[model samples]
Every structure is written in C-alpha cells, then in structure tokens.
Target: MKKLLIIGTMPIILDMNADSSSDSEEEEIGETEETTQKPITCLISHDECYVAPQLLNELYVEIFARVPCSEYWKLQFLNKRFSQLLKSSEIFRMRQKLGLVKPYLFLLSSGANRWTMFDKDFESFLKLPKLSSNICFFNGDKEVTSVGTQLIVIGKEVEGITVWRFELEMQKWVKGPAMITPRVMFGSASHGTNAFFAGGVKIDKNSYEVVSIAEKYNAETKTWTAIHAMHKRRKLCSGFFLRGKFYVLGGQNENDEYLTCAESYNEVTDSWELIPNMLKDMPVLFSQAPPRIAVVNDNLYLLETSLNELHVYDVNANAWKKLGVVPVGAHFTRGWGVAFKSVGDELLVIGASSARPQSQSMTVYKCRPDVEEIVWEECKRCCRGVRLNHFILNCCVMLA
Candidate 1:
C-alpha cells in the first residue's frame, strides 16, 4: 500500500514496496531502513502549517456569554452544538457569574403593540415579538420591570388586570399571574424574585382617585401579597429597590400637584419611612409624563420630566445632588416623553426630537454620572422624518 503525508498544500509520497519472506525478516528490514534513512523534510506555508485548536465546550460557553442577546438566535445556524449550548441556561449563568452580561434596551413604541430592542454593543435595533393580544396595551399606562432573566409587563385591560412575562431564553411572552388590583399609572420595582408595586391612580367613577395601595408579587410562587402602603398617594412616580429597601419618589398627589417628598419601604419591618425630599426648594413635576429613574452603583438617579435635569440621591449622605441637564435638541419639548435606563456605567435616554418642520427624529443620549460634571453625548439618531409623537411608550434595560 502507498503512504502519503500531507504537510501543507503539497502531499509527500513515501515508498513502502519492500517485501519479506517471513515476519522476522520483515521486521529486521523495517528496523534497518528506519535507522539508516534520512527523514524527508517539507516546508509548510504559514496558512497551512497548523490548524487552530478546536474550542472546548466550556470555552465556547464563555465566548457565547459575551455575545449580544439579539444575535444569539442567529448563531444557532452554525451547528447543532451551538444551538444546544445557546439554549442551555448554563451559558447565561456563566455570563452572570463572570459579569459578562450586558443590559439590553427594550423599547415599546406607543400606538403599536410590537416592541423594539436596542443593543448597545452592536449599536443596532431589533424588533421583538409582538403582543399576543390587543389587551396587552393599556393606553400608555403600562408598567414594566425585570425579574431575574424575565421581563414583566403589568397593565389593566377591559377584562381585568393583565400581566405578561417575557422569557429571555425562549424569546416569547407568556401569560403571568394576574394582579389582585387592576391599577394604572403605578410605580413598580423588582428585587430578586419579587416585584413591588406602589401608589397610583385608579378610576373610581368618572374622575380618577389616587390610591396608596402597595403590593409585591412573587415570581416563583406566582402570587401577590399586599405590602404596606405609602404615606401619601402618588401617581406617575418612580420606584426602585436599593439597599434592601424599596424607594418611591417624585410624583403627583391627589390634588394633581407635583411632589418633592420621597419615602422608602423596609420589607423586613413591613413599614414605610418618610425620607428627605429629592429637591429641597423645587418640586419634581410630571405633568407632561412620568419621571424616569435608574439605579447605578448604590445611587438612585431621577430624571425630572419638566426640567430635563438629572438628580442623584446618595444613600449614605441621604441627600440629592443635581447632576446636569441632558442635551436634547433645542426643538425638543422639556423632556416630556424621554425614556431613561442605566446600561452598565452609562445612563441611556431615548426620545423624539424635531428633525424638520413637520417630522420628528429619534435620538438617544448616553450620559455619564459625575458629581462635578455629568455630560450627555448623542449616541444614536434614528426614526428620521417620522412622527414619533407618543410613539415611544416605555423603555427598560434587561441584562443578557
């Protein structure tokens, strides 16, 4: 039989034509030839000298963890192993453990049931699954929060309280447990496996009544438990969980007046304590829209809707310090419809700005938090020449 050794693009042929009468004679001849013959040398090209080492399953998982969530589905076509590995929760667990998980911005446009996601790493937009039914939209009063790896949307429909949970791995939405009360324009925050809902206005008759009711939903148990209500009725407020407590700040009261007071709820004691006002002299107004809040590090950031100013609440100092005004286009109206979320170390603000005489443009600003000077830089510009009035309904960040 002929023997061939492929060292590069070139193939080397070896002669193995020697014959022997017996096994002993053949063994002796082979030994003599191997000892006396000079080894053939071949020069291999740089591209064909060595092949890259195949990645181990564990290494592949680590690499996949850094990939943006929007691109995960497209990677399945590479091979079956990738499809299986991408589906496994182990990769995401590794991502979370290694701190490789990045926050993905999910935007829900008004007057449309479909959702669009913005991936900061890739700087691209992706359309997510549409709402299964029209009941998912709640006249721009829906509240959204993230619990673990799932995105939960809470709102009221004609039928009753509607809740939907979007499983990140499955990339689909499923019916979640209904709320005990059908509320709108409420404040919500999530910690661990539970989500806390705070004060909001509910329709009593023809007029709207501000309610101080509060509740927490357990994602694991799929049940709701009533928590201690806030001291004052609040609607269009911002709620967030920080340092083992839920804080609700800055909203309109029963008289439809803007509020500057803030409060925190301690679940361990089942009580709400009044905290210092976010602004000492000025009131936080949300007449045009709800205030936006994001938690970065241990500080809570509040974006005033009317003034377009950024304020940070220091947990240790127990004081609010003015950051800086976000740089929206001059033609924009008082930051009324801007959406805010914290992605990694940067704060992302998205909204519509005047592009031309009659058209609106979508703009995204990335703001860095600093005590001396917090600066806002334009990161993305989209939806040009399109009317984005009331189009951006809600925005939230999901770590993936």
Candidate 2:
C-alpha cells in the first residue's frame, strides 16, 4: 500500500520504477516515474483548531464537547458538519447536564385549593373540577415536594375516604389511601419525607369554626401524628419554606380582620416566632389585601395585595424596598387563586380565584428583574383554568 499525506494545498505523489529492456521499456519507465504535486488551500479563523482530516472528527468531539456553549456555538459556524453535531443528541445531553431542558412543573390539587410546582423550566398544574371535595397533595422532599400521584377526598363521615393516584406511564388515576383529617381550607407543607397539615375549618356549616390543630404525615411510613400548635390560628394563609424556616403569612383570625401578621417555624429548634410587623410603615392600600411572598435568589419578595406593590427584602442587606406594582386590576379578582412561581430567572405571577362576580380564569405574568415595567401577562394559556395559591417550584423528574 502507498500512503500520501496532504497538508494545506500541497499534494505529494510517490512513484517507483525498475530499469528493463529496450525503447518501449524506457517509455514505460519514464511514465511510471512521472509524479504530480498540487498546492492545497485552507483557511482557519482560529489557530488552535488546525488538524489533519483523519483526526478532525475525533478532535471536534473532544473539543466542542467540553467547551462552554458560548464557545461551542462559535465553532458551529465553521462547517456544516459541526453545525449538525451541535444540534444532535449528544449536544442535548450536554444541555441536560447544564439544566437546559424544559424544566419541571408539578400541578397539585386538594378538594378546595390548587397549586403549581416547578423549578428551572418545567411546570405542572393540578386539575380541579367544579364542586368537588376531598383533595390533598403529598411528597417526601420538603424542599421540593411532588404532587403525589395520590388523591384523597373526605365524604360525609370520617370513614368516607376516597383515594386516587395517577400513573404517568399508563396515563390514568388509580385509588390510594384515605385522609386522616376530613376538612377544607387547610394549609399543607412538606419537609423531608413528611407532609404537615394545619389550620382549616371543618366546615360543618352551622357548626363551622376554624380548626387550630396541626398534624404531620409521613408519605414513606404512611402514618399521621399531631404536631406543635401554632401561636396564632391561621386559615387560607400562605405557607412556604424559606431559609430553613416555615413562614405562615396573612390568614384570617377569628374576627377575620385580614391580619397582616407573619410567623415563622424553625425546623432546627422546632419553635415558632412572630416576625415583626414590617408592612405597616407602608400605607394600607387595600384593607382586604392578601399578602403573598416569593424568594428570588436569597431575597424575599412580598407582594402586598392592598397596593399591588412589590416589596423586596434583601437577605444580605436586611433591607426592604418597594420596587414596582403589579398591573392594575390584578388582585382580589381571583380570590384565593393568586400565586407566584419561579420560572427560570424570573418569577411567574399567576392570578387565580374570583374576587369579583367573574368567571374563574388564571393569568401568569413574568416578574422581571427590572424594578420598573415588570412584565405581567395572562398565563391562562399555560395554566389552563387550574388555579394556584402559594405555588412552589421544585426540581424532580426532568421531562423534555
């Protein structure tokens, strides 16, 4: 076998001949010794990438595979082959590791309340039909809970417990366990492998009274136990885990004065503390306002219902500033349905519940980093008619 190595436009040919007989042999010998050479032209924008053709493919897979996307895309324009590989499955695998695929959103439902769950780009919502009862969402991770495939509804008696579970592969809902507490207007938050339920009226109608009891349920152990009591009773209050603390905010007291107080439960010490009244310095824009909060980065954002104002509290600075207001006519329209969910780098402001005599609809707006002119748009197309209150984002199964 003969080998020829070509670099640039320069081509080298190998020739061999053996001297033999007469004039005819001399002609054959001259033809065999004749060699052709051509100069090869090549262009390169970057000097580092130059390589021989045989090793080019291997070089690319090794180089761009590890290069940051900003640098990899620049290489993509070099040739059609590189561009195709950039859009190929291998590159998407790189993106998956980078957390770039459509992120996770889990929709959770209870008999009376609904919430959306997500982290990164994924989002999901729980579906609720009209006039249904007996519902709860469960998960083991308190930091990022899942709307368990399980569903529970309480009938007229404590024994009347109905359970349902959704199988993703089969795409159907099957039966599960019965809830220990048959009540509505309760708040549920998960920590570790257990979910805690607190503060809901049993809704006995004529016997209607707010319930102050707290209970914790283990999804793994499948058991329930009553926990420490809350300092002040709260119903329809927002529940969230922030900075290793459980924050319960803005629920009605026995008199239902639209309490503007906030309380925190520490998991480390198993204690509850009343946070100082901070929003009072700001005017009471709406006496009926339901305050909501969202944590972006490490900062806490308080969405005051009264003024449609966005007050941000910096965790590092321990300071508060009113950045901007939600669009007009945003709140109280969907009563208990309003919530904030994080989508990528921004917060998704979802409007739910009916504050007025209006149809049940949901709107989601993107809260921008810019203090002025934050974007608020209707997220109905994405959320459907499902409403979310205290929507929390979590990272679970990544669905591309």
Candidate 3:
C-alpha cells in the first residue's frame, strides 16, 4: 500500500466534479460549468488494492494522507469506507499533523480572465473556476495568496474593492469573508495553513492611502486576525516566511518613493523589528514589481531585476552575493512579469527566454541555490503545448 503512494508521476485527468453529492465542506472537489474544457490530474501509478475491514480507521487515514490530494478522487475505488474518508477532512487534517504537503503553482496571466493550476512537475494543469465578481475584479490589478486549501484573490469590483477565494477542497470560487480593511498591491506569504497579508494601499472614494496594517488569515476558521503593523507604510512589497518568522521586503512608500528597508515580524514577541536599509544595495528599476525574492532553507535569495542575476543574502553581514544570471529573462520588463518563488528546496523561475528579447512562450527553470554549485534545470515538458502569456500578472505557490 505504501508503494502505491510513492509511485512516480503518472498524469491522469481529475474530474473535480466527480463527487459533488457529498455534503463535506472540506472536499469540494469540483463544480465546473464549462463542460468543454479539459480536466485535471494527479501523481499516480496503477496498482491493485484491498481494504482490510479490520484495519483501524486511524491507520488508513495515516496511509491515505501520503497520497497526493489530487489523487483523492481515485481513492474512492478502494472501498466504501475509503470513499467516506475522502469526502471528509480527516485525512487532510492528518496530513497537516504529519507536515506532509506538495506545492502547486497557480498562475494568472495577462489579458486572461481564467487562472491555471499546474502540478509541481508541470505534468498536467487545471483551470480554476472563474471569478464570480464584477468586471473590475477581472481588469484591475490582483494580489493573490493561498492559505491551506484556499487560494485568495484580491482586487476591485464594480462599486468597490472585493476579495475572491478559490477553495481547493470545494473546487470553486467563493465570494466574501472579505478583508477587515480591503486593500490592493499588498505583500502576502503563506506558511502551512495560514497566510499573511501586509503593507498595501487602501482606496476610499477618490483618494487612496498606502497602508502599514498587517493581517493573518486562518484557513480552518475562515477568519482574519489583525497583527502588529509594520513601522513603515509601503506598497508593492514582497512577503516571505523564514525560520519561523515573517519578513516583508522592499516596496514603494506612501510618498511615492522607493524604500530600501524591510520589517520582520516575530510571532513570539508580537512585534515587528524594523530592518533598516536591508535592501540598500539591491538593484531594481525606478518602478516595477517588488523585489524578486524567495527563501529556501532559511537563506534568502534575490533576483537582481536589472541584471537578471541571482544573489544570495548574507545573514551575518547583511549583504548579497551574486550567483550569476538566471536562465530566464527579467531585465526587459524590470522584473514585472516574472514568477519567482521557492518550490520546495529549488528556486523556481518562470519568464521570457532572454533578458531583452520577447516570446509568447515562457521558459520554466529551477535551481538549487543553497548548494556549492548552481545550475538552472529547465522543465522542457512545461515549455511545450499551449504557451502561457509571457507576462505573468500574478503567481502563487500553494502547499496542499
């Protein structure tokens, strides 16, 4: 049974609508109205299985948690008992207890209303349910982050700003449970089942104010808790989690000036420690996306937008060491369109083929920057097929 869980990636279509009859809140597999579109898949292998009626349910839950959540639908074939467990959140809860998770990359491209979800290896993809809000939510700028099984998308609607969430378990877009103070251009990051949002602009009437407020969302409770605000008011910043701490890095301030400083939030102390001039030497354009930064194994790595080069942060010296250019381009757009994030231990970057040239097809590459040697390995499988919009409006990595 354990062997069935560790098999290599075998792509299979996931009909998210497979079991809509279940009344479980955590297992909303699929609710798609587009019958013409393709389905999703899971990392799987074909094998025989038999359920022992005498086996403890706890043991089964432990075993099933090892399987990818994308493959949960297939588990119904095991037996009636297994089917019941799949509909419930018991196995998912066990997964969290065991700290077992896989990252799924969600991307929203330019000029496109629908978002796409790709498996870790980019073996197969799934289109998220369309947003149920007004046109403003689609055309305006969007900030996205995922907490646990939910993918939260924030943007404006017709009359005012709104928040839309893509619930992975329910397999649909749900409106509301909005932010305590609705915002845009915020810095957001996720750790485990919780997501953190901080430092953005709040628009009311004709005026918009850059804000320093911070909030945390608990996926289980479906609620938000306000936290200690950062010492600085900045928008267009980036948020990352490292060493049990949340860090907010480089962004533009309320005065329309670029800020080189950063802030680190200590959950234990319940306070934010201002890290002044943390990015004083960082390279960026006059106006662009937040610093292209991602953390792996407690070390922070940054992409120099002007050079398309990779640099590692020195925690002791508070400096950066250049690691050479990434396989993808970034200089042309000044780092606006690139999707930079840490996928497990490797640094995953998706962008154009060159620093200056443009292409309809984006390149996908990953590298282990923590080791002695840094080599960008291109996911050739991901580059093929229908190409993505070269300019990524937003990208998020959700651990399920």
Which candidate number has the best TM-score? 3
Task: Estimate every model's Cα lDDT from 0 to 1.
Answer: 0.66, 0.46, 0.77
Q: Enumerate residue pairs that collide in model 1.
A: 110-391
How far out, in Å, is residue 368 in model 1? 1.5
lDDT by residue for model 3 (1-400), tens = 1112333343222333333334331121112333213211111221223323333356557756877766666677655556777656677688878988778999988767888889888878887778777776778888989877788888988777788888675466788788898899888898767889999999998989999999988877778899999999999999999789899998999998999988989988779999888888876577877898999888999988888889999888888899988876688788999998888889999877774365677678888887788989878899344568878888989888
Who wins the lDDT comparison? Answer: 3
> Candidate 1 local accuracy as lDDT?
0.66
Query: What's the ranking of the predictions by lDDT, best on top?
Result: 3, 1, 2
Residue 11: error of model 3 in Å? 21
Tens-place lDDT digits, model 1, residues 65-125: 7666665676565555566665566667788889877667777765655677666642566
TM-score of 2: 0.52
Question: 110, model 2: CA deviation in Å?
Answer: 15
Per-model TM values vs. the true structure: 0.70, 0.52, 0.81
Q: What is the lDDT of residue 243 in candidate 1?
A: 75
lDDT of 3 at 154: 88
- On the 0 to 100 scale, the lDDT of residue 106 in model 2 is 46
